[model samples]
Target: MTYVPDPARYDGRMPYRRSGRSGLLLPAISLGMWHNFGGNKPYENSKAMIHKAFDLGITHFDLANNYGPPPGSAEETFGRVLADGLRTHRDELIVSTKAGWQMWDGPYGDLGSRKYLIASLDQSLKRMGLDYVDVFYSHRPDPDTPLEETMGALDAIVRQGKALYVGISSYSAEQTREAARILKQLGTPCLIHQPSYSMFDRWIERPAQAGAPVLTEVLGEEGIGSIAFCPLAQGLLTSRYLDGIPADSRAAAIDNPFLTADKVEVRLAQVRALNGIAAARGQSLAQMALAWALQTVTSVIIGASRVEQIVENVGAVERLEFSADELAKIEAVLKG
Candidate 1:
């Protein structure tokens, strides 16, 4: 069957926000290709999720060089989707990829060095079969490398027409400030920052002992937008674990190391309390969790393995508003 996109896909069902004072407008919820879209997963299933996401007005698709279990497989999979289905709508999509993690073995395979970034992006472009990505991110801050060098490479990538905008991920507030300054001096403003933010992980809201501002505040002051990853805490915020870890769940999967049984047990009570609040508000736990992250950030990146999951997650846009009392209740639950 021909994969034709819905004509009414952009009928304002999903809200778009300006990415950090930039001209680019990203969907409130962007789909991330971190897990489940790799070679280990079924190709047809992954394709269905991507198609479903676009049909739901999710124009932004985020990926990274080291996303897949085997590394680089996710990009390769996305490349197939682009060639087969999304080629006609290329201009309407915001596709992004990143580096700065351990991509390949050896000295130049990882980090924010100029050589590694440039080469890694080249490989990423080849894997995705695209001339340029909408945004290219240094996936993490490289403490060993000078800020000027990493920011310079990002600026050069923009100038070379390889990436329309540049960003940093998992960078500390202080590091973000310095990188933004350097990119500005280099004639390329840092457009956005990708940080891991969820009710369980509130590092971005914590006051830095070094006197640096919180990450969200710094980005606001610097005119940089933010996109939060792991807004659901990797299934902890979802109903899938309410009863117990399903045998097929990510926590039970041997390949996934980030989420384990012990980790889920520690947060079970908190999740149960949060579920109660979600029930009272007439929304799913996952939806409320995403809305909580979006209360401050510009956008949230969602990872889905199934088409139904994408459909349900996109419903978060509908119930984004929360009253003051609701906010306090959520805070109380987190603190408790």
Candidate 2:
């Protein structure tokens, strides 16, 4: 079989927003390969989601070095998908991958050191069968590494033509300011920041102090765009838990590190309340959550285990706005 992309992919069904004063405009929702694209999964299953996402005008596919259960498998899966047919549309895509985590055994294989960042991306490009990635990220701030070295590695990657743009993830507001400043001096302005943000996880929206700027404020002041990760809070914001965690849910997976059944039980009240609000708005809880998060970030990275999930998640764009009372109610639920 062959891939014939939906000619109407750009027919205004999806909106593209400017990324923090950059020349790039990313789709409001980008697909993330943090799960379900692993080697252990059925190849056709993963490929279907990728194809479906692109048809829905999702031009960005986000990945990280340690994304798979076995690590490095997600990129391999994506690479295979591209080799199948998606590679022909490579120029129309924004393919990104990250480093700054424990990828290999040695000390030189992890963190923000110039050596690690460079080597990690090289391996990533190799795994994805690409000469370069559209965007490369630091993934996480290295507490033991100097900001200059990390940002410098990003700059050098751009200079090397291996990465068109560079970004950071999980850096604090002050840390973001310093990282952006260094990248600016190096002539490669930070393109974006990936942070953990959602209705349940709102640290990125808070000020460092009583009157200090939040991470988003720092990003706004620096003209850096952001794409929020974990915006669904590992399925807690979805209808999957509104009734109760299913046996197949992430929370029910005994080995799943992100969510646990016990935690889901504790938060069932809030989840059900949010679900009620979502129903009133004619949207699924996941859709409402994504819509709400989109109001603050440039885009929300969505993960999926099936193609149907991608379709439902992308439908969030259909109703991206909400009333002030809805926001107030949501705030009440969260606070309570």
lDDT of 1 by residue, 1-336 (tens): 678998889998899999888999999999999999999999999999999999999999999999886799999999999998787899999999999999998999999999999999999999999999999999998989999999999999999999999999999989999999999999999999999999999999875776768888899899999999999999889999999889988899886788988889888998999999998988999999998899889999999988998888889999999999999999999998
Off by over 4 Å in 1: none
Model 2 lDDT at residue 198: 93
Global lDDT scores for all candidate models: 0.93, 0.94
- Clashing residue pairs in candidate 2 are none
What residue pairs clash in candidate 1, if any at all? Answer: 20-225
Error in Å for residue 257 of model 1: 3.1
> Which segments of candidate 2 are over 4 A away from where they belong?
210-212
Per-residue lDDT, model 1, residue 75, is 96
- Candidate 1 has a TM-score of 0.98
Best by lDDT: 2
